[model samples]
Target: MAAPTADSASPADSTDPTNPADPTRPVLDCRGVWKTFGKGRDRTPVLRGIDLAVHEHEVVVLIGASGSGKSTLLRCVNLLERVDDGTIHLDGDDITDPRVNADAVRQRIGIVFQAFNLFPHLTVLDNITLAPRRVHRRARAEAEQAALDLLDRVGLAGKAREYPDRLSGGQQQRAAIVRALVNSPRLMLFDEVTSALDPELVGEVLALVSDLKGDGMTMVIATHEMGFARRVADRVCFLDRGVILEQGRPEQVLDNPAEPRTRQFLQRLLDTEPA
Candidate 1:
């Protein structure tokens, strides 16, 4: 995995379509990001001075405790939550700028949350095709064809016609991932995707995500599954109290953490894991 490097350089030219991950830049860049909620003295800082860069095809996994700000960081990247400070760049474009079109930028990002959030009335195919049809103006046949191909890729070809209610929790989550992929996004974000699934069902969703990484997808994932994180991540970031306390290769960070906070955190997680 390519590690993020800090840069004090000015923004690249807009006319230049140079790849952000082309050794000189990262595909997803979050520079000095800070996010907070509430007002005045009651303010709560969720993310503090976060500077992360994800190069093309790199998988960066964030591991932390419940209040560590992992979800908030992902939300900030997708522009679902506005950042209180700093800049977020996607493929060299400053996505956090108020002038940037939010919908247009979202077309290039695929995010899957803990919830499936599939439309109960829609078939799996419809759920997957909704964004392409309504937002991208893709014709019905074209969108359905793409959705079918994605479903097949995830071993859910036969479930395309099935309603969300008819599928198992794992199946529903997989469909949700497919829905996010219908736009063919350049960046994928997963926010504890398997947290809501039964242990037996969690493997299927995690397997699909691992396969996505094999396909060279650049992704930023927040997961409690330490095993899954070790298997998929090129780099691991451990957050503590809204800040990245330690980050390194999975072997170094997950196995032999340099920071005491990280070591204690990983030890607690290990204690909870079944024998």
Candidate 2:
């Protein structure tokens, strides 16, 4: 199947007005956020003054070129990489505060990266259960049961006993997603999760994400998949050189971007796709 052209109406279009999130208290809020790597002259800014608010059950998609800080913004939100300046609040709690427990904050959020990142030695069940059992102090039986249920939900019940290497790319990614879900996170962050998958395998993973959206999982996704973004996102933000240059509903931002840079970026993406 071909990707939707930029002008195509998103499946989410009709549902946009039905899913209004309260702007007063967002599930995730990033204000004046900045991240820079290296020291002194070697310093290179990755995120610059990122101000974004994701409401409960809202899916916000970040889109841009490779180095535009989409991944960095998600990493900072997950507390994987500490920001150099500014603050991030998850459900109004200041997660970026120096005194805040990072691990405790992480328990409220789940993130899946491009790579499956499943432990090779662990069976899929074990890989999925590790966090709940060890970190959350869940009972072994409870965690394993939860893992099995999620695996079943993702159509991977049979593969639960198998190792990551034994599964297809799609299966491994689904397991990673199930692992993320087992913790019952209030928010999920996806960073180019399907980029490593074969073209035919992308749909299964995207379908899983679509199911999550239907279930009202609040999510922040960083992706180059414009069609998927259009389909799933409540809002789309276009990042450029560490800044969000444009943001709006997918149709508004994708179909009729106000910024020249946004137009250029969308054009480049459209150019690379098969006609």
Candidate 3:
């Protein structure tokens, strides 16, 4: 896979011609995007103005303290949380437009949450197959086969018949990842995926992600695992106060940080002993 070329288009343009030529047109692009919460007069801006681009087969990690809009930014990429301003493009197609089919867009971009959202009533195999069978109109046999293959890729093939509750936190998270990957999405969004795991189980989940990174899966992860960010991310972005404070290569941003806020955040994160 190739790297994405820089694009300079206004939010209004529906098409991004540069994308096709580049071959690495970002799988996700958010430009000057904003999001607000609350009703009418008391609305609070959660994402002020976020500008981010994620290329094909690249892993971009977003780091920030609580309420820094890191999660919101990831949500906006998939339109789970709509932006109040600016534009979001997926595969060079504008998704911010009201006329776009959000469900279709979502199918191309899979998201894994901190809380594994697997259905308790369903077995791991069913949990992974349900979406493809329903949304893509795939035959049950076909979906099941794909799900099994994905489960194997995630090292959870033997647990196909197990329920979510029957699995450990790490196992459950890996199942969630397999569920998302079964769709063969062009981009993957991970919002603090390891935050809910037990300390003893975090390493297992991170190892799965590291393996995915090695496979050149395009991913945007919001996390506090500086070590994972340093190791897997092609680029690291430090977000603060609903804005990106600084962004660069992991070595530059995590080790030789230029921004005071980034340096402070790293210091605080490093103060804690490794889990």
Candidate 4:
């Protein structure tokens, strides 16, 4: 698939993102956000004036080609990367502000990447309890109980005592997800989480995410899995060249896109699929 060019449409031209608003404030709100890497002549812009809002219990899926700023946007929202312009608000608090406590902000948000990133030496239980025990200052027994409960929920209760290397790719990723959830984050960010798993393993992870949606966990997922996106997303945002070119209900954006760029991108994904 082709990367969206800057000439396609400006952020000003995109549709409003507040279509699915509710009485409660959005869990995540990004306004005119921008991020650029490098300096001087080597500067490469990754995100440009991205405006998006993810309301409570809403699942917003971001779809675009590689380097279209999907991961970068998620990173920015997580406060791993600072925005060069604009602001990011989590639960109405401006987390982008310099005064904001990034670590504290992170405690409320959970982000899982394609890689499992579990510690090789730590058991699955240890991996899940590390953050809550150390950062949140929860007692060992309390943290362990919580971890075990979450592990059970994700079908990994028996594997809690097993080290990372002993588990399969699907189990490891689910372990990683359980680690993220053990913190009780108010919002979740999934960045191509199933990309590293085998085809057969992918469903288990997707099913877990579906269950999270059913539990009303607000999420912003960046994924190449269009079918999963269609099934899970409350709204689908077609990001192009660092801006949302189109967004609406899943069927509207994925099956009947209004923009030519959106249609072209979707067609490329369909063309690459195996018979």
Candidate 5:
């Protein structure tokens, strides 16, 4: 497959030149996003003053130690977690606005988690079809076909009839990804998708993600997979203490980190890698 092109559409243009019929704008745009837990004066801020933009077909990877708010940031993008302040825009519409429909906004953005959230009772095929049929009001046959195609895209078509318990960790995770893709999301949010997998199994999920990158899927991934981030991300963002410490091209941030904290984190990660 050919690599997906960057979003050539301007902010003022409502129609995406890359995907004209898709209503979602710019993939994702956020400004001054903040998430704090607890009451005033005792609140713990998970994300503070985050401003980010992701264009169509771009892959931006968020890298940081646990508790750095990477996952919280992803949740904010999809409105899974409400922001105490700031704004989030998806496909050019303000999702953070009170008038915007949250369910409608979610259709344009799909999220996959570290744990495979597959339904145990349902076959992989059913797992992928449920949302489209129920939420999008798609016909059963149409949804099934879409699910099958997504499963094939994620290399899980052969296991579509199998239950979640019958699959390996990597296979289950891939199924979860297919479920997200079946919704035709313009932007995908991956929150530590490989963190729960066994060491050997991580490659399969990463390979699937790499393939998606090749196909030009717009995505924001929060992960600790340094190699994957370096290879697949168009931009790498380092987050610490609820703020983006640094962000730039992968080569600049991963190989030639400018911040002292980023350097220290990378050093520790590299040191822990097996010889």
Candidate 6:
């Protein structure tokens, strides 16, 4: 079967086409993106032509069932997985270009996964400052001070000297988030960040994300927490069969979805839970 067709209409600029290269454009833009795994006859397309634009300070959430291509889409955006076709523009630069330095592009975007992946022996402060001090060439004192400030903001200042194992699951997750933020990324991508947490711990990690949103951070998140998504996402996109079936304001997409597939998916998700 053929992949889904690319739709270049951006929710932020479906009307304006004058200065397509405007400097103050969307922080992340994926045009006609396609990704596949496996080889030859066994090849399976995960992201079948996803075109999306995430404006500055906007919170865009990707929603779908398992294997619906939500994680693949985010991976392609982060360049963790290469696209089979199409262009990805990060702040007006074609980051998908073969000539582009992947490491350089990655430095500008922060991504967090379901796993904390923090170093076991490193103190919380060390975990957060490692990249900035080593990769960006910041002085040790400067990086440590900045890391402390971020930890304080998340109410983990007292635990900065503690190792990842010493902190609660929620604290570890929040520390991971702060580690990402220390790089001062232009965009942030999250893939089921709270999925591994205990139910009670989920809210602590989520609260830090809420604080980031309030501070005008540009983020693209994939999550199963529909209630949090509804509250924090400026827009929510429903994916199906490797395509974005529908996207709009959270209220519209989550409450009055026009796509039957999306409605069915949401219904099944809600039904699985007592809510």
Model 1, range 1-275, lDDT digits (tens) per residue? 12233222223322232354456577887876889999999999998878787878889999999989999999999999999987888888989899999999989999999988889999999899999999999999999999999999998999999999999999999999999988989999999999999999999999999999999999999999999999999989898887777887889889899889999999999888888
Question: 38, model 3: CA deviation in Å?
Answer: 1.2
Better of 5 and 6 by TM-score: 6
Distance from true location, Cα of 76 in model 5, Å: 0.8
Task: Show pairs that collide, candidate 2.
Answer: none
Off by over 4 Å in 3: 1-19, 22-24
Worst 10 residues of 5 by lDDT: 1-10
lDDT of 5 by residue, 1-275 (tens): 11122323223233432454655446677767889988979989998888677888989999999999999999888888888887777765778887878888888888999998899999999899999989989999999898888788777889999999999999999999988888888999999999999999999999999898998999999999999999999999899998888888899899899999999999999999898
RMSD of each: 4.0, 7.1, 4.1, 4.9, 5.8, 2.8
| Tens digits of lDDT, candidate 2, 1-275 | 12211322222112222233634466776767899998999999998887777778889999999999999999999999999887787876889988999999999999998998999999999999999999999999999998998899999999989999999999999999999999999999999999999999999999999999999999999999999999999989999998878888999999999999999999999999989
Best by TM-score: 6
If the candidates were sorted by their TM-score against the true structure, best first, what order would they fall in? Answer: 6, 1, 4, 3, 2, 5
TM-score of 1: 0.92
Q: Could you tally the backbone clashes for each prediction?
A: 0, 0, 0, 0, 3, 0
Candidate 6 lDDT (Cα, 0 to 1): 0.87
Give the poorly placed runs of model 4, Cα more than 4 Å off: 1-24
Instruction: Estimate the TM-score for candidate 5.
Output: 0.89
- Local accuracy of candidate 4 as per-residue lDDT tens digits, 1-275: 12322322213224333334534456677877999999999998899888787778889999999999999999999999999998777876889999999999999999998898999989999999999999999999999999999999999999999999999999999999999999999999999999999999999999999999999999999999999999999888988888888888899899899999999999999999986
Name every residue pair that clashes in candidate 1. Answer: none
Model with the higher lDDT, candidate 1 or 5: 1
> What are the per-residue Cα lDDT tens digits for candidate 3 across 1-275?
11222323222234362466765466777777889999999999988877777777889899999999988888888888878998888877889998989999999988999999999999999999988999999999999999988788778989999989999999999999999988889998999999998889999899999898888899999998888899999888899988878888899889898889989988988887565
List the global CA lDDT of all models. Answer: 0.87, 0.87, 0.85, 0.88, 0.85, 0.87
Per-model TM-score on C-alpha atoms: 0.92, 0.91, 0.91, 0.92, 0.89, 0.93
TM-score attained by model 6? 0.93
Could you give candidate 6's per-residue lDDT for residues 130-185 as a string of tens digits? 99988999999999999999899899999999999999889999999999999999
